[model samples]
Target: MQATRTEEKTAETHGGASSPQPQQRLRDKKVGDLIAGKKRLVEVPYTASLADTINTLVANRIMAVAVAAPPGQWIGAGGSMILESDKQTGAVRKHYIGMVTMLDVLAHIAGNDVAPAVEGGGGGGGELERKMQVPVSTIIGHCLESLSLWTLNYNTSILDCMEVFSKGIHRALVPVDGHLENVGGVELMESASSYHMVTQMDLIKFLKVHEAELRGILTRRVRELGGLTDIVFGVTDKTNVIDAIKCMNSASLHAVPIVESTDEIGDDHGQLVNGKDRKLVGTFSATDLRGCPISQLQSCLHMNIVDFLEKLLDTPQQEACGLRTSTREHITCQPESLLREVVDKAINSHVHRVWVVDGRGLLAGLVSLADIIRMMRVWMLSEPA
Candidate 1:
């Protein structure tokens, strides 16, 4: 995406035919510039049912969507949909409540309160349907508060967005400047002029496009960069899918490593034995639930996570029908690997995080999109004189 205003301003400031340094251009780039080329925002009302919300996410092929307050509560009666501002006094009106993601849905389904109902055999399908009918607002309570929706002003700098994402905020909403429109007593966000969702992937893609200018930072090894940690959370290969989901939900993790361990001596928390030698076998993620039918998911919950993944990947039905499933093989990087390699693996594999391994192929830590962005922010701020 081109940064029209920022580019024009930069070109004007530097003499014609000469461009500003890449670092200066990136620092001056604003959230509005990044979002200017993005598609219109997708949103769901707070009162929308969980089933509707799930359908919307699948239909849009998006992992999350902004949840907004009901119509009249957030906007006034006008035939134009605009930013949350009063037409007369120009005061702000808070419209968006938060974001509801696929993880939230998985957490709700795998929560302690709902697990028993799901495991109870009699009329379980009906119960699952009932749970799906609950309003989307109910799902927000099960999500990590840190993952809640954040807003950024259009003029906010790209560096500021990197800071936020570095702190584990997955996505932020950028409200486009526009007028509020009401149609037949219902406020509607105009397709051409609505909020744009900025994600870590967007920033990563931007970095990739500008990688030529970032050779110095990209060539550095992950170990030398110092973001890698020894602490890693994962589950044993024998862990049940339901228990794995619970562990991830409680920890607010997008994905967890599945390790092979012979020692079963541990609390039945479905986690790997701490301080034991384990080999990275696979992974289970909240994104695995994408496009999964509720009926199919309920049945798979009781299966072993590794078995479930194998079935998901090797099932003839999926392969024959050409269905999209979370079939990505586990991706890993070493501490000695270049940062650019990690970034390329994440973007090319279309995965959120990459596992870090020692020379023995044992789990060490993980590098997420957030971690990469954090490193970039550090590099930008610590550029040598």
Candidate 2:
């Protein structure tokens, strides 16, 4: 029930003594300071139309767009697991509010389940379709109820924020000055409203810059981090771009790996002997969609994903298709690789996730920037940043 507990606790504990200026005694500095540097929180009102939501996210190319899920209307995600009902009585678990992503917009546009139908069943499906084009607030009450919202205090440490993200929550909101902006159902403070969004990407950038200072954590192996998992989402190169986007949209992913087939994850393509299948070759992202003829993008949900990637890659074959210009490439690392190595590769390449390959060079899991920063087991690292 206490969504803003962290902020409230900090204010109560640091009352009067809390300086507006950064805390100097920590020597290394706190995550709170890092968050303070971010300048705005990108948000859309709960009343915003689905098209508006897509524009807000795609235009900003951000991980999350805040929905105005204010206190009472939404619960904050990822804090102490046992901090409920007082362990004095025994811990009571609670489900945190969920967050929204581009997937929501894409799904709505494509007619995918955005969460069970809001309100009562419609007498006429046509009327419901007509209503969807109207303001989102008509159905936002139900929509926000189903979302995961993470709330943290500006004073929360980097370590804690990492834990919050590690729990599978993509983004978070930190309460600053009390003047609130009613962004849909979510509330925001006026101080620096837009910068309130805290994503794993932001945290990764921080780690990259402080790599040396944080070597103890960075030196750990990727495989040792429990967060690393297999390439769970992918598709054959033949799947059309539209279907691929649907998959990505449903899973709320930025990109999906392109492979030969769902054939078990081994590089032993030699078994096919006379077969002409390509190996685990290239991957594509939503960003790649930008390279396609601008018009195609607006209508590309049903287009071939291969054609889209090809258009972006602009291969000799694609050039024959009238593609005049373009750009792109791939990057990956091994499970045994150190976090620092993955960190360097991702930073240098300006990519989001590094494919984790097996000893046989087969695709395994990915070391995503979000997953990298969210690997909180490293919090126990011996060295201090």
Best-matching candidate per TM-score: 1
Worst 10 residues of 2 by lDDT: 78-87
Put down candidate 2 lDDT per residue, 44-95, tens digits, no spaces. Answer: 6656775465455556656346555333443333221111122344333222
Worst 10 residues of 1 by lDDT: 179-188
lDDT of 1 by residue, 127-177 (tens): 567778998876774668423445566766777778887877777666676
Best by lDDT: 1
Supply candidate 2's per-residue lDDT for 169: 56
Tell me each candidate's RMSD, in Å, in order. 7.5, 12.6
Q: Could you give me the TM-score of model 2 versus the true structure? A: 0.62
